[model samples]
Target: MAKHPSLQTSKHQRFWKNRRVFLTGHTGFKGAWLSLWLISVGAKVTGYALKAPTEPNLFELLELRKDMISIVADIRDLGRLKAEMKKAKPDIVIHMAAQPIVRRSYKNPPETYETNVMGTVNLFEAVRACKSVRVVLNITTDKVYENKEIDKAYKESESLGGYDPYSASKACSEIVTASYRHSFFNPNEYGKHKVAVASARAGNVIGGGDWASDRLVPDCVRAVLRGKKIEIRNPGATRPWQYVLDPLNGYLLLCERLYKNGAKFAGAWNIGPDLKDCKSVGWIARKFCDYWGSSKTCSIQKGKHPHEAHFLKLDNLKAKKQLGWYPKWDINEALSKVVEWTKAYESGLGVREISEKQIRDFEGFPQLNDAELY
Candidate 1:
């Protein structure tokens, strides 16, 4: 196993200090976490996205609106998007807004493509018009690759294809990003353009403050909390499970690289867990039950469901070798953290405190330095 890299507080503060960041999908699970991290590190953030998708969402749980500029709008609204980006004049842009559910795509393919594909186009168009932007990272999924269900892990060089609408839409988004990168933000003209463009494909991300439906971890959390049996739809489905901070950390590092190196780091990259962390849905649910000490427990659900890839894994060698990024928490640790966060929520403890503590812990910041950093 490759050794995990240590994140120095000075290194983070030095890079992120006074940096202007324009983040989309800031109301979602991963986006909210990134937003908080950015704010903690002294980055000036302007979050543009629709209202929280769920009633009890992290954005509200953390009370994130008061700290940063929050804009509630649609990604397809090009005019609105352009105006917001122009006003923000961000040094870095992280595009994460999308219809993120796989099963939901089957019910609404048109909406999926419209948001995932056209939304990306609109973001790049806005980026093209904005001169202050130095780096733009589009967040896609590991399912963007064509899955053969083999034992082999997918690499950055893997062929792009998708069986389901959600996956296919993300694949389209990847193509759109590449088109804009080549046609507008060309690497050869980096000196003139002064912009870096890249895409990140991450694995199945599980964390607290995620109340989204049709996901395994959230389902487990909901079930355990409600004293209901956690239903397992596809027990054998295997995926590259990763803690939320693992890839968010990778995003911060990638953005830093793209900002400094420009064209050299402008391309597709995979930010995922080690191969051993990829496990089946049933395995995750069982482990989650164990950690939560759930009395209701889990039960397999029998029904025909939409087609999903049975086995999916990502090869993180490029990120490891070039970016010095590797997964810090394994599957067990990730689940334990989820349990911790969920239990804190159940106990009515201040989530922001626990969240910030977890963030500090994840970054290896000492207790004595809290006064200095925050």
Candidate 2:
């Protein structure tokens, strides 16, 4: 694996240590990374989700089940999810389980809505019933914003709208979260500890261990590894691309704030990269090839591509000023680290070691500096 530059001390590490965290969708790519990171910091984590979506997904590859109380359950199953939540009795809850893909949403709209909207509602209901739960962080997508093909970065105050099934479902999830916060956890009826909820909207995340279809980085990595040219559905599509860890840090920071301040910090927040890093799909593909030493090229698919937004970006000034959070890695460095991790995993290295190495590298934890320690 290529050497990753040292990261500065993040408040996320210090705040999360020894915390009891319930993470939904622990079997997904981003959720697996978050679970591993939480475990690395000595947090007790209980994960509730289905099996890994794909065989090579980060959930199975990293063996997160070993560190977490992995419960094979679906978010749509209210009884099962509530039972697990009640048993875990976690202090903090992060709801990331959702129908996360746009193309797949087209194939199964009902499943997408059931999982994304009603699943979120059910999770919030469970959080309300759990007396031990103090802070809840709901993860939504940047696509929740109503796009008009404009160049301006989206702010948290922007209207929630979506044209696609996946995006609309997330938007609906946000609505559900807000409704619960107002109706159930109102300051008048329920005290701060009664429940604090914050919705987090993040930009397009790219990283290693994501074997999902219809994503830029994963598609490119899979294609390059198999010596095939990547088919770019929308080559000119612009997105705010950041490393997976970038938003994960923001999520943790938000959780810390909610834990400490309770209702004072309850609201929607955007955790995205700097606006300047927003680049087109083609630009990101070329950069990936350069870093991975692959000459693979991407061609715009003539007719198979579905309708997608041409431009999307986020204004993270709210997070920077309010939460004091900023992305530590640029697009180039983020892509480099992702490629390095995948290369190492593909070389027959232990997945647990690879996962721990990333956490150690990002947190600058001295004890895990040596890979042999894992």
Please name the candidate that would achieve the greatest TM-score relative to the true structure. 1
lDDT of 1 by residue, 230-273 (tens): 99899999999998988999999999999989999999999988
Q: What value of lDDT does candidate 1 attain over all alpha carbons?
A: 0.90
Error of 1 at 302 (Å): 1.1
Query: What tens digits encode model 2's per-residue C-alpha lDDT throughout 39-149?
Result: 766688999988888767888777667677999888988888888899998999999888899999989999999999999989987886788998889999899999978
TM-score of 2: 0.92
List the candidates' TM-scores in order. 0.95, 0.92
Error of 1 at 364 (Å): 0.7
Question: lDDT of each model, Cα atoms only?
Answer: 0.90, 0.84
Q: Candidate 2, which segments miss by more than 4 Å at Cα?
A: 1-13, 187-193, 365-374
Residue 53 accuracy (lDDT) in model 2:
89
